[model samples]
Target: MPPIQLVVFDMAGTTVTDQHEVERCFTEAAAQTSLPVSPERILAVQGMGKRQVFQMLWAEQLGEQHPELERHVNTSYAAFRHILETHYQTQGASPTEGCLDTFAYLHKRGIAIALTTGFYRAVTDIILEKLGWLDGLNEQHVGTSDSLIQASVASDEVAEGRPAPLLIERAMHLLGVTDPKAVVNVGDTPSDLLSGQAAGVRLNLGVVNGTHSLDQLQPHPHDQLLASLAELPAVLEAL
Candidate 1:
């Protein structure tokens, strides 16, 4: 097998510690906007962009062409943003177990790390800044020379979010990774797995320590499913 050149990771649930805070935000926003979205329905779309999630849910509730659809989407999305931002600001952000160590291990092997997220740039920056991961970032190139992750791509930067390969493709381009077969994509959602699979990456891994369980991720398209990010190093070494 060819050596992996880049590892693309999902932000919130994969690398960052998310205790369903995002889902809670979505649920609360939906309730506030009278969108009538169920918790199960919200969790089902965990890896999609925030605004898109609202748009989709609202479209389902009120037909896509409904005159009020756009207004409801905007209202719910704004509420979600405010709620989410406040939660992160007060609750703080932390990396998941073994996430930093895994990053260190990859860095030692001269592999590039790129973080992709369903979040827009503002919220993404908040999380990065809270974790102090943005300290050494190079504004011109958008990655850091001495940071754990080499680059980051947000949903706002691309035309589409997860389940689409655009995020992975954008990360590869920014990180100077030319071969899709030499890339590994890891996340905790079905959309994350689909994105990697669509990108034709060598390894599409799902870690079951975040938003989804093994059962939840089992039905998705993935090469391997591990207990957590802690097991990634061994998996890569064995490759």
Candidate 2:
């Protein structure tokens, strides 16, 4: 059997943990600030970078001119970040089941495991450090969480991110993986699914372990679906 080359990931729902508390956190912040961000609004931006979430909510709820929304989101997000940093290491933000085992197995098989989140470097590093998730990873080899940043990469690198293939392309290049047929992308969000599809990766598997329901996630043409990352190894074995 041929080996899987690179297994790329989206961090929040893919590796960090689940969102049961996250909504509560958002709700608490919204009530405190009296902003328009609701639990569902927060859910819409679950896999996004923290700042991006703020920006999205700002635009949708407050408009581009409202710096107050930015302030509110930052302050609110800071509150959440503090809590997460304290507890997320051991508890995880909502890491999918079996993700650790699958990632470990991929490493053992010499399949490069790469990750990208919507986070900025500081936030990304904090989560990785707190969770000890980046313990064995090489900083140079890992892709930075620069998804929403302009000037993030050179034009030759990738086309776009999420629903676009740019981030995966960058990860593949950094890992020296050239074959689209030998790679897979595992994620819990539809954005991840569409990103894989855009990158032309060999497999794009969706997991219901994140905020999105299967019905909403099903329209994107995923190659496979599972209830959790726990099913990943067996799925790979079958593949």
Highest TM-score against the true fold, candidate: 1
Model 2 per-residue lDDT tens digits across residues 1-239: 34688777777666667565556655666566565765666665555455555556656777788768667767766766665555555554434688777766765666677776655455566666665555545545353232111111221233334556777777777767788778888777777787788878888988887767788678866998888888887888787
Global lDDT of each candidate: 0.90, 0.65
lDDT for residue 14 in candidate 1, whole number 0-100: 95
In model 1, where is the ten-residue run with the lowest total lDDT? 139-148
TM-score of each: 0.97, 0.74
Please report the TM-score between candidate 1 and the true structure. 0.97
**Which runs of model 2 end up more than 4 angstroms from their true locations?**
1-3, 65-80, 86-95, 141-163
**Which residue pairs collide in model 2, if any?**
16-95, 17-94, 17-95, 18-94, 49-118
Q: Where in model 1 is the C-alpha error above 4 Å?
A: none
